[model samples]
Target: MDIKVLGPGCPKCHETERLVKEVVAELSVDASVDKITDLMKIAGYGVFGTPAVVVDGEVKSVGKIPKKEEIKTWIEG
Candidate 1:
């Protein structure tokens, strides 16, 4: 699975990244997590939010840090 966290390195963005990692680790899922800190790249995701989560190249959530369970479910699904 390809997971991408998009943001400009804000607190929420960092939290999202951390939580995503935790979720992935707990589930033992083989996934690649990428942090998209570049403005151009983040904007290309069509997200104006500070923190965004994308799974399998699809935008899952934006503008806030998602719950770990929610993230895990997303990844598992």
Candidate 2:
């Protein structure tokens, strides 16, 4: 699985990225987690909000720090 966390390195963005990595590690899912910070790249995903989560090229969350349970559901689903 491919997961991308889009942000420009804000605190919320950092927390979001951290939570994503934590969940991925705990689940032991074979996935690549990437942080996309470039404005053009983030826009390419059609996400105007920072701290967006994209899984398998699909937008899952945007503009908020999703809870741990939410993150887990995204990973599992």
Candidate 3:
């Protein structure tokens, strides 16, 4: 699976990335997580908010930190 954490390298963005990593590790799922800091790239995903989580090209969450259980569901689903 391919996941992208989109933000401008803010604290919330970092936290999102960390949560994604933790979920990936706990689930033992093979996935690639990329932090997207470019405005153009982030806009390309149609996400206008920071700390957005994209899983397999789909927007999963935006603007806030998501729970680990919710993240796990996104990864496994």
TM-scores, all models, native as reference: 0.96, 0.96, 0.96
- Give the TM-score comparing model 1 with the true structure, all chains together: 0.96
Best candidate (score: lDDT): 2
Q: Candidate 2 at 66: error in angstroms?
A: 0.7
Off by over 4 Å in 3: none
| Candidate 1 lDDT by residue in tens digits, 1-77 | 99999989988899999999988888889999999999999899898686999999889998988998889888989
Give per-residue lDDT, candidate 3, residue 4.
94
Candidate 1: count the clashes: 0
* Best-first order by lDDT: 2, 3, 1
Tell me model 3's lDDT, rounded to 2 decimals: 0.93
Which digits, one per residue and each the tens of the lDDT, describe model 2 over residues 1-77? 99999999999999999999999999999999999999999999998699999999899999999999998998999
Worst 10 residues of 1 by lDDT: 41-50
- lDDT-wise, the better of 1 and 3 is 3
RMSD of each: 0.7, 0.6, 0.6
